[model samples]
Target: MKTAVSIPDRIFEAAEQYARRRGIPRSQVYAEALARFMAEQESDEELTEALNRVCAEVDTSLDEFGRAAARRVVLPASEW
Candidate 1:
């Protein structure tokens, strides 16, 4: 399928660079990105809803919230 879409110069340049670095055609890069983006969009809505439910439960239980926070260790900025 062939379609024409106009993109900003900066975005085009970045995509071209990424395609060159990955040794793939620009179309393939765009296709992969679009697929990933669509998948995320489809799943994010459900994930967000689940997270909201969990957060609502946390509001009623500080212990649960504390345990959840403790499970995630904060790393130093240098690691990032």
Candidate 2:
């Protein structure tokens, strides 16, 4: 696919230098960068979905003793 977009002159110069040094086209550099970015975004979504599923299956309620312990751990000053 062909597209056009704007970027900072400094970043363009750096990408140009990188492509020139590696003897690869500028398009490949941009394509690889976009691919890595998309992969990371997808991985983050997958991690969030997996965490939600695990949280849904576990017990989240606290008993009286557990609540007291949690309060002491959180506040540590007031009498229970």
Candidate 3:
């Protein structure tokens, strides 16, 4: 499956370097990166939905509730 796509020069350079270092074709590196990116996008959508649900349950806006939730999870000073 051959297709044409345009990417930034810096991204192309990094992909070429990765392919050479791993001894694989540049297409393989691009394919794997695209797959990972798609998966992460899907995960992010799910996370957003879950966060929205939690916010609704608490009857608060996402921004306000997310910060409050973060503040609740206190870690010892040593952990920092």
| Per-model root-mean-square deviation over C-alphas | 7.7, 4.9, 7.9
- What is the lDDT ranking, best to worst? 2, 3, 1
lDDT, candidate 1, residue 25?
100
Each candidate structure's TM-score, on Cα atoms with residue i matched to residue i, is 0.58, 0.74, 0.67
Question: Model 3 reaches what TM-score against the true structure?
Answer: 0.67
lDDT (C-alpha) at residue 38 in model 2 = 100
The list of candidate 3 runs beyond 4 A from truth reads 61-80
Give the winner by TM-score: 2
Q: lDDT of each structure?
A: 0.86, 0.94, 0.88
Task: Report the backbone clash tally of model 2.
Answer: 0
lDDT of 3 at 78: 34
Prediction-by-prediction clash tally: 0, 0, 0
Model 2 agreement with the true structure over 13-74: per-residue lDDT tens digits = 99999999999999999999999999999999999999999989998788998999988786
lDDT of 1 by residue, 1-80 (tens): 99999999999999999999989999998999999999999899989999999988875554866766655654332364
